[model samples]
Target: MAANVEDFKKRLDEQDLHIRESWVAAMKARIVRGELIKCQRGEGVNHYKHCRDLAEMYTGMIRENKVKGYKIIDTE
Candidate 1:
């Protein structure tokens, strides 16, 4: 048995997540983080930590540039 194929498909459809859209969202997030690092700063004790974290996130996205999910009906 495929274990309730209808239920599985219903759940999957409910999610309605698209891989390309997810990747684009991630890219936009990275761009915002980069903009913060380059164009904003704060006067506080944790300012350095905040900036470092942003930089790390921006670079980390470079290594992780893929969206993972189901690929039904492969056209390739």
Candidate 2:
């Protein structure tokens, strides 16, 4: 039983890694699609970091399994 548990955990880790990579890819795509254009809340806002911030917000909500916690913060 212990062996089985370890195997399951390992598999889950692998799957989660894949999901994380996918989320990062999707976030990049979203940013490339003009999703980060003028994403500031007001004047004197960010210009370069907004893309990364928005991408992190988007990826935070994505999940590949129920064991993961999804925290989505509005960036735009």
Clashing residue pair totals per candidate (backbone < 3 A): 0, 0
Report the number of the highest-TM-score candidate: 2
lDDT over C-alpha atoms for residue 58 of model 2: 52
TM-score, prediction 1? 0.36
- Tell me the lDDT of candidate 1: 0.67
Cα RMSD for predicted model 1: 6.8
Return the TM-score for each candidate structure: 0.36, 0.44
- lDDT for every model? 0.67, 0.59
Worst 10 residues of 1 by lDDT: 36-45
Task: List, residue by residue over 22-56, the lDDT tens digit for candidate 1.
Answer: 67868776786767656445635666665766666
Show the lowest summed lDDT stretch of 10 residues, model 2: 62-71
